[model samples]
Target: MFPIRDHNPSGRVPYVTYTLLAVNIAVFLFYWFSLPSDFALAKFYYTWGVVPAWLMQGEGYSGLITHMFLHGGWMHLAGNMLFLWIFGDNLEDQMGHVGYLLFYLACGVLAALLQVAGDPSFDGPLIGASGAIAGVLGGYLVLFPRAKVDVLFIFVIFFRVFSISAWIVLGIWFAVQSFNGYAATDDGVAYLAHIGGFIAGAVLVLPVLMRRGGAGFWARNQGKPPHPAAEYPVTPSRIPRVPRR
Candidate 1:
């Protein structure tokens, strides 16, 4: 199941989240524009993407931040932005613009460090905003465990949309990251960074929530939403209608 949207609404505009999305897309265009060929693009990735071995060897240290804006393909960028768009606004509302901006960059930094720790000897360039976006998901889960997230489920020859709580959706996503991190070696995705950034987000955002007073924050705002939830049209089930007399 993939999350389509969330019930929680932002109290204020999420400028940082918008800026992040714009920057990632712009950087991707720049990468494509700079290249004369696909090989040139690949070479650029080798230089800028997070190569853990080179990082550990004290080279390409800047990539830890730069690589967050560099996705490997269309689907990679789409998936990361989807998560960011769904979960980011609420966190941005909670943290405010400046605070949320710092939080995002810090998460990316911690995420890359986690990837390095997981495999310092690997030479592949780890790229994508997924780690940072995963951090946003983690923060959203802790702050709004009961928030409703609309998910679109696709099965062979069938598709449906439904809603579930943040705990179930983000929780399952976290579990899968851990599972894949352990299960696959050559997948080339940094599941470890995703998992690690998630953990960091949960830990780092706790104090902000606590300072606002944990239970009191929820109490004042209600567990449902601080603003109006996004409305969606409920579709009827696809079971064939029985002929009636």
Candidate 2:
């Protein structure tokens, strides 16, 4: 299942979120088109992507920030951007543009640090905005746990859309990351970074949550979006429901 969108709407335009989306896409396109070969692309990634070994060696210091802007492939970019588009606006609205931007970068840097701590001897290039975007998801859960998100569920030929609470979605996501991190298989994914970013986001956003009234904030909104949620018309599926014989 993948989250296609959310019913929650931001109170104001999220300029920083949009800019981040544009910048990530732009950077991906620039290197994708400009780099003539796979080797050159790999070289570029090494220069910008976070390499735990290098970072631990006191090198590639810039990768902590730069790596968040890089993606390994089209799907990588699309998935991260989709999450950002869905959850980022609400955060940007709550934190304000400048605050949200700083939070995002801080989460990304912290995520990388956690990944480096996880495997300081590994030399592979860790590239993607997911570490940061995971933070957005983390913050969204704390701020709007009951907000409805429309997730598209696909199972072989069967397809359906389900509107579920944000906490369930983000909670499951964090659980999976935690499981994978502990599994410790060489799957080429930075599960530790995801965990770190998510924790960082939840902890960092606590101050804002407190300012709003801590648990009282949840009492006031009942964990739903602070504003009226956007309504989506339920579309009937083309597949006919068969009656049991």
Candidate 3:
């Protein structure tokens, strides 16, 4: 199942979220076009992407932040951006632009540190905004546990969309990451980083939630968006129907 959208609407324009999306895309495109060859691109990634071994050696420390903007492929970038777009706005609305930006960066840094802790000797480049986006998912869960998120589920040839609560969707995601982090033998994906970032995001957002009245806030809003849900026009199916005898 993949999330398509959420029912939560931000009270204000999420300028910071939009800016982050633009910057990530621009950075990816710049590297894609400017790098002379695949080898050159790999070299670039090694230089900028988080390499735990190098970081442990007190080198490439800047990569903790830089690596968040670098993606390994188009699909990687697309998936990260989609998650950021969906969950980021609401968080930003609650935290304010400056606070949210700092929160995002802090989560990324903590995530990189956790990944390094997981395998400090590994030299492979760890790159992607997934850790940071995972943080957003965590924050979203804390603030909007009952918010509706539309997920598209595909099983074999059958496909359908289901609206699920944020708690269910994010809870399952966190569980999967934890399970994979324990089960995987090779240090391929940074599941540890995802777990770390999620925890950090949830922890960091606590003060903000408390200021907003905590349980009282939930009681008032019921974890729904503060604004009216956006209206989406329904379109009639265009596929030709077969007549039945």
Candidate 4:
């Protein structure tokens, strides 16, 4: 199951979020077309993507930032952008454009550092904006824990959409990442970076939360977005339901 959308909408357009999406897509297209072979693509990734060994060796310092824009495949780019699209605007709405952008970059860099620290010897390239997007999720959880997010759950032939609380969704996600990171699973995913980015995001947003009145913020908004929660018309699923034998 994955999130499809959220019931909370930002009060204003999130220009930074949109621009980040466009830039990531553009960068992916640029390398996808320019590179003719898998070898070349791998070489490009090594140069731009964060390699724990190189980074720990005090080299390729720029990869910490550049790596956030480099994605391994279309699905990687799509998944990260989708999360950003859903949760980023609200955080941007609270933090403002410049501040959100800085927060995103800082989270990405810190996440990379944690990943490097986790396995300083790993030589593979780590690429994607997931770490930064995870940061947005972290901030969203703190600011709007009760916001309703519509998640699409599919079990083989059966599929359904469920509107659940933000904390449950993000909380579960963080838990899974934490477990995987601690287990040191070889899934080629940077779970450590995700963990670090999430913590960094949550901590970074504390100032904003305090400005809004700390616990009073939660008391006032009741952990939901300040604006009226959006109501989506329930539409029947297109898939035909099969009768159980």
Candidate 5:
């Protein structure tokens, strides 16, 4: 199951979120297409992406922040940006542009540190905005547990969209990440980073929630977006009709 969208709409335009999307896409395109060779790309990633061992050695300390802006491929970039777009606007609305930006970066840094702690000896470069996005997911869960999120399920050719509670979607996602982090033996995916980022997001949002009246806030808003839900029109399919002979 993949999330298509959420019912919660931001009160104001999420300038930070939009800027982040554009910047990530632009950075990925520039590096992905302009790199001359695989070796050169590897070198570039080594410089920018997190290498736990290198970090432990007091080198590449900047990778924690740089890594989040880099992605492995189109799918990697697309997936992260999709999550950011869906969850980030509401967060930006609540935290304001500057505060939300700082929160995002803090979660990302903490996530990278946790990943490094998970296996400080591993030297492979870790890249992607997933850690930070996972943090956003955590924050969203805390602030909008009752909000509706539309998830698209695909099984072979069968396709369906289901509207479910944010808690369910985020809960399931956290469970999967936790299980994977425990069972993972390979270095390809940084499940630990995802876990760490999620925890950070959840914990970090608590202060804001408290200031907003905490349980009282939930009671008042019913854990939904403060603004009216945005309506999107479903477009008709454009398949051409076969003329009867």
Candidate 6:
């Protein structure tokens, strides 16, 4: 399942989100050509991506920051960008451009540390903007629990888009990540980073949320947007073609 868009639109263009995307793209381009040799690319990731053991050994501490821009593959990059584009604008709107940038960096670092706490001895380099984008999801959930997020759910031959409350979607996402964390013994995913970043986003947004007048913000905005919503043209489903059986 994937999110196409959300009914809640931001009041302004999210400069921070756009800049984040650009930076990720640029960093990927710099390393895209280095993937022909797995060992070479792995070395690059080891130097830039978060390596729990190295950090614990008091080295390569910069990966806590650089790792957020490194992604494992195209699908990984696309998925992270989609979530950031959908949920990030709202948080950026609330926090403003500069504030959101710092907030994002902080979440990325904290999430890496949390991943270390989950398995400090693992040598695999954790890469992807997922942890930071997961943070944005966290902030969005807390600030607008009532907002509508349209998610695409697919089960084999079936595909459906459902509009649900933000809380329900994000809450379930967090639960699944945590469950995966508990179930996996090693290296399948950095699910704990996702959980940690989410918690960080929720906690970090508290001050910004309160400054906006706590419940009064919801009262004025109806927990939605103050302007017309952004519409994503619904995709038409294709009926499977079969010979007259």
Best by lDDT: 4
lDDT of 2 by residue, 1-245 (tens): 98999997898999999999999999999999999999999999999999989988899999999999999889989999999999999899989899999999999999999999988999989989988998888899999999899999999999989999999999999999999999986778899999999999998899989998989988888897688889898789999999999
Clashes of each: 0, 0, 0, 0, 0, 0
Q: Give the CA lDDT, 0 to 100, for residue 202 in model 5.
A: 97
Stretches off by above 4 angstroms in model 2 are: 235-245
Error of 6 at 17 (Å): 0.4
- lDDT for 25 in candidate 3 is 100
Extract clashing residue pairs from model 5: none
* Tens digits of lDDT, candidate 3, 110-190: 988998998899998989998888889999999999998999999999998888999999999999999999997464679
Worst 10 residues of 3 by lDDT: 225-234
Model 1 bad stretches (over 4 Å): 222-224, 235-245
Provide the lowest-lDDT 10-residue window in model 1: 220-229
Candidate 6 achieves a global lDDT of 0.87
Tens digits of per-residue lDDT for model 4, 123-242: 999899988888889999999999899999999999999999999999999999999998989888999999999999999999999999999989998898887888899789899999
TM-score of 6: 0.91
- Writing each residue's lDDT as its tens digit, candidate 6 over 10-80 gives 88888889989999988888788756887889899998998898889998898999999998888888888
Best candidate per TM-score, number? 3
Error of 3 at 66 (Å): 0.3
- For model 6, how many clashes? 0
* Candidate with the larger TM-score of 1 and 3: 3
TM-score, every prediction = 0.92, 0.95, 0.95, 0.95, 0.94, 0.91
- Among residues 3 or more apart in sequence or in different chains, the pairs in candidate 3 whose N, CA or C atoms overlap within 3 Å are none
| Model 2 TM | 0.95
